[model samples]
Target: MVAFASLKCIIISSLLLPSEAFAPQSNLVNKKVSESSTSLAGVGKVVNRVKDSLLSKERSREDLKIGIAGFYDRSSQIWEEVWGEHMHHGYYVPEDRTDHVQAQIDLIDEVLKWAGVPEPTGDNKDELPKKCVDVGCGIGGSSRHIAKKYGCTANGITLSPYQAGRGNELAKEQGVDDLCSFQVADALEQPFEDNTFDLIWSLESGEHMPDKEKFVNELFRVATPGGRIIIVTWCHRDLEEGEEGLTKKEEKLLAKINRAYYLPRWCSVDDYVRILKENGAVDIKREDWSYIIAPFWKAVIKSSLNLKSLVGLLKSGFSTQRGAYAMFLMLRGFNKGLIKFGLITCTKPKE
Candidate 1:
């Protein structure tokens, strides 16, 4: 039964995965491999069969940017048409019926509120940041939101040229182009002057970074002293005291996910806290929002089931299709407690 379950997980997993836009991303591939994560791992030959079936390939570090850029470039417009901007997970609570697109918007506001991004002045008079940077910025959704909300200039970066161009075009149409700018750039080596941005926001993009510490270091380097940085991302669960790395089962699950999503080795929120501290960041805080975002993948799965989603996906090409089917693994990982929707916030100490 364990082998059967493991086979099921890998088969579904080996199939491919998605954006937090998860829904309308545009659909889960086939349901044959749809067993839970608890049923995955320790099934060797079946893993090979599933991998072969999916034709999943491991990308090198050199190819990470290319792979990620390709995935988004092919999939972003399809998702924008189907899911409506905000290509990240939605915030949800039991019995709450907010529309999914709005829920995605709510996540940005919720994360900033939790981070005390503006430091809560109680009079809506908190010092608005003069300049902000959205690292791993996808399609300029959050950038435009921040720019429009605070009247601040917001700059965004992405590896996908399509995203950079489309995001800029969308901002122009939305009348926020003057306040929002986007470029194709690497997050590990950011392209801004030092002591620049006062607020750094990275939503969901940290999952794609190959170097966690370098990502943090870059954020710190670009930030003004006293700047606030918030990273809301996907992370593996923290290791318990006395444990080493993730258990073999967890590794298997995440490995399949890595192949699907072009992710590098994952770290925990605890690891992030350590990195922030090492970088001399102050006021560190972290939280796990697994429960609150539980509805996200389910919503995505539902959205991807329709005809329009399918037609759009078919045209988006192979990797996007693989990503579409692999989304169930995201749910299975969450259900099994191997994956976490993590939030971490810290401030560069004023010097």
Candidate 2:
């Protein structure tokens, strides 16, 4: 077994430092360029050329989507065996800092609390959601949680057939089969009627979307008027007007992370805010939970050393093994402030 005690000590010690120490350097170049006007114009052309080159080199969206499904199909069992049902990060409480499982559960609760989702009670049928949809539901953990908590009927969609089957099995096991269901469906083209769901919940799925505009529109299409939409995902830092975009180093790092995780690309939280606003969503709010969720990678890294996880990682083949290695990259990215854990909530305008 991994030396969990020593690992915990190291992670806890590192996390105690001031948050500013983790902030990445800004890419804004404040100095004025003294080159000739012709030279400046040429430089702009060269920059555009480089940007186009990078865009052309990105993986095809269809291939990436297929790859992501395969990645999860192969690795789902490993995740379930090691990290429990919730496939996302955890929230650590200073007072109740006990084990990883409870911390993960607490993270789910924290996300709901941050999104201002009221706790459901048997008496609040009118107040609670009647229909919910979990876009990118991983093994139906969040779907089951919502269904049981609010007595709502939930539908979960994922690209992986294995995950869909497993999620249904889990729902049956938890005695929520009637309340929740899972199916293989694409988020970009969700198989649901417009205004179908009272709540649309997406957790850690936004990163996989290659066409973010289409993704957001799909969410809106499936949601009822005044329906609550909550999204939690990875985001990059926002770029200011007149400031340069990501540096070459940052781009290269992100490219590597994307390949390992089967993600298309990452957008800034501000980008998401703008899209939500343009889509006519109201009460738009955002929170950066990066600091709170920073400790998750450490816990996952330590857990990977367990014999069961090691065996599973090996059995799952190269992609899953690479993903395990990428955990270190995520840790570094968070520490450098290049990666952000973001939460955004909005409501469709009541017509």
Candidate 3:
């Protein structure tokens, strides 16, 4: 939990954007998002009931979707409420921020290595829009990194207005504000010309998208010929030979994950790769990285349970109880082999 005073200090000192820029209405969901406010309202209503069913202190998968969604919706509020305490809102934080930053660079290096793009030259270090977009650019952390490292401007698109404003502020603080810009827009209906970006980065955000095909196709459409797209996402492992698939208990757990974390479904990596290939993305390489994620969350749970964390949660009004439940689901999903981590790198033909 993060104290309100701390949050206020962080927001006030770090964010100096114009009111229009930070306002909720300024950011908009991606294109093709349903405009049915009533639908959202209704979902919000049932979200609670579903959550209660899922987190009843007993294992059950019936109504898992509702349970999962409820957990997520609750968790989202808590994350936002205590944004100052958890950098990047509980996304994995590398032990060192600089190391985390460099890892992203290495990820990009891997992508460019595969895409066959020539290394940059000294003469053209500062370039604009030479073709990179970070989908789900939460808080613009990665966008700022890319801008600083490559001297190229990258458009970051996200649905959360709060994240966009804060991300821009961080950009300014880091002196990369000029090169990186964040908009409250949906990645699905990205507002860019077709065949525009040389690289499309979708990092751990695919699970939130309901229409996986459309999501990948949008990436394909925006990417130039010979361009590359790198996607890292959370997935559910493939069904085993004689096991019941996605028991009600599991569905509820996943739904809790979705609701709390804003994911739609934890689809399989095979499904994701197939979607990319179906949409004309070629030479797809897919790998399951669940081995890394499960243990990662286990450590987070331990850290969160520390004495300082307990004290912080009690002092802050934010619901750390809900946060613990979410972590539990995440850990359990990972341990049971129901959850998976996946990465895919694909390229569009130059011709």
Candidate 4:
């Protein structure tokens, strides 16, 4: 029955939805409603209920929460050191650098390009910003890039106040301060007027949202008529329910990821697209970049083992146990084929 439902849901979702399925609402109260609506809508309601009954009790484990916090705390320290910013995933290093570090940064640049962010110029606002919002703007690397490359004003928001502060500092240093600003804001309840941003860029942040539809809808609402939203996120494979619960391997993998990485939940690329379309986005385009992004987690695991980095991490007062937990989760997620790295772009219609 579970497998049949998973397959059925996949077919319905894939055939219809866009990517903004995880997007949120206008303010605080309605935010919850939007979230509930998106999750409970159509097939999602069934999936959510089943998942909750099976996993909700374990979802709030203290040890898991602590581990995730440590994971963020440790990684943020390393990011600040490397890029003079607080980005969690990777950085944009120019193509001309001579070192291994520079080469890796170049790879990040490629990902950004692949993700559709144009190369940064000294003057960005003129090119990129008809209106823009950078979701989860860790350390402001990409946000600054958006402002500099497009020469348009941008509002970069993050759940982590630390990330926002660091992003603002870097933006100021890079002289894109006037065009780019950072705010400590929830992606689920963005603090912007409707129809404000022309471009919304969410880099690997959608996984953290518990109520997926609200998050996507909020992005849609802020987008000016005919504006665009781009999402590059970590996701899980489409489920195929069988005799037991949710493929034991897959369930374990998702639980591990959620426990270690602070992600509220993970969903399939097809489901993501469905929610977006249902929420009113049109002409959605999606591409799975899992093959290219698969190695990023490998690199993260490697970085977690650096002795010098470990020393800093220790001094930073984070838990090595939690770091281990996160790495282990990443490994499990990859091995089980439960996580996917994907990209989506869509345009809101002009009213």
Candidate 5:
């Protein structure tokens, strides 16, 4: 009980840092300009745009990258210790009680199943993709899984160098190093040639993208003609017809989530489909898996109650703890139907 109290304190305190850290500095000159400005209405509109798109304040690309890398650097190992190698949410079945870790692996299989990515049914496993990319791969769990299952080479990329290094170490330890490679790379500008990968997989990474269009374009650019692309991400509810945008209350809630997770902005699953279509993707598919993933955050909260998890969170630093606190907010958003667990899949048309 005492330990829990300390954890609560850390979470609350860390939560206060985001706005201060990201807000632009004030100065006399800026104040004078504000005083001299005639059109404050336009500035308010601009501020709202930035708030919804960036955060409470503007964040440079480098700042966002560094924050994301630093958060993972501190927390990735702890997450591995607690949540296993797959750092994304688990897919649970109705009254289907399974071990938490297995649910995570099931999530991988389920995603592939939903995407219609077939696995080898015969002895020849090479029927699957020969080369695949796992964008924002966490510790290369999905990468190694795909490589082993398909008898293919899998490349995993992440901004966190620690994730890359640890992923490689795990691949070596698991005897899949020859089939897997992990490197520190940005998803926005993937370091791959056009039409190179037979499969492009991005699970739960699209939220960190500042430019959703560019992010999808990059994914499409590296795909071989007729290759598969799967993206499972967190998105807000789609706006109703004739609605210009989300309500301020909804934006405020998401803005809190964005700050805690080092996320750039929130977009709906519909937005992802539109972006994919605009980027020349064909056979686009999308689903709202919110109900399937509904229990994820609650399950995470339950796991974090133990003494070991608390110790780990304390050691991992404030960023991780802040994210830990945000878990409740995540649950709130999901319950209120403001947040969604979105899945999108598309095929690169054959040229």
Candidate 6:
């Protein structure tokens, strides 16, 4: 295990810019609803009683941070080689579009459009954000794209030093080094002043947060009043009224995913809406984007089967290999409706 203290020090040092750390009191609470005593409930009870379960559990944030950082540190090169720069899922328009790179870029574009961020025109420089921050940025792909598209200064924060370094190299190579930068930082304890960024973005990073409430709060805390925030993440299905929670099979499958990906837990899309509301965000909208992103795993599975990808996976480490295999598990989960792709957009109210 990576030493927690050492990792914390490394993250703090890698922040690059000096700012006071915001420490919000955690208001995380777990609530369970009572099950109805009906025939359907009896059937659900029988299902739960028959099988062992491995539902989401609390994990040490320090350990989780270390594990995730190490995983990305090792696997980033392999991903860059096999999947290009974007580490998140793609958005399919026609449901059959197969150009992987363009699809990933379109995912970003779609997200921006959903958030009502306008396309950059040379005439209207004032319409774009002056500053932006990307939480859990992987190799700064989204960061570079935002800088190039909007002519905005973007700061991308990740847990992996390798990702941060490589992202900086890419920014320099793309001639956006001055406008875009990358750093190793913690999402729960970001190193930035309150209300610093005009836009805050998090793509598929929420599941890795050990403290989801704190993660959401930090995003809101760093955004300037009226700043836009967009998040895309993996979510599980929300329980219906009086329905029992995840089935044993679903729990076991999620456990495999958690182990493979270093994720702390998966929440429902409704959970995110509640978190955003609790954090005082307004103009909130949530979209179930499961179908659009479902094709991404299939593409990844196909890409992973190639000779170059296999060699890279082997050289990366055991964790990468495990995660690569887990792609099939994710595909199964998606097919079974056990996993969902959720997108949320909101804004901090102007003070």
Clashing pairs in 2: none
Clashes of each: 11, 0, 17, 31, 0, 0
Assess candidate 5 and give its lDDT.
0.73
Clashes of 3: 17
Q: Give the TM-score of candidate 3.
A: 0.67
TM-scores for every predicted model = 0.83, 0.81, 0.67, 0.69, 0.82, 0.81
Q: What value of lDDT does candidate 2 attain over all alpha carbons? A: 0.72
Question: Which window of 10 residues has the lowest lDDT sum in candidate 1?
Answer: 1-10
lDDT of 3 by residue, 91-113 (tens): 23343333332443454455445
Cα deviation in Å at residue 56, candidate 6?
12
Where does candidate 6 clash, by residue pair? none
Best by TM-score: 1
Best-to-worst order by lDDT is: 5, 1, 6, 2, 4, 3
lDDT of 4 at 290: 57
Count backbone clashes in candidate 2: 0
Best by lDDT: 5
Tens digits of lDDT, candidate 5, 48-150: 4433543456566788889888777766765666567887777788625557678778888989988888868876555478899999897888999889878
Local distance difference test, candidate 6: 0.72
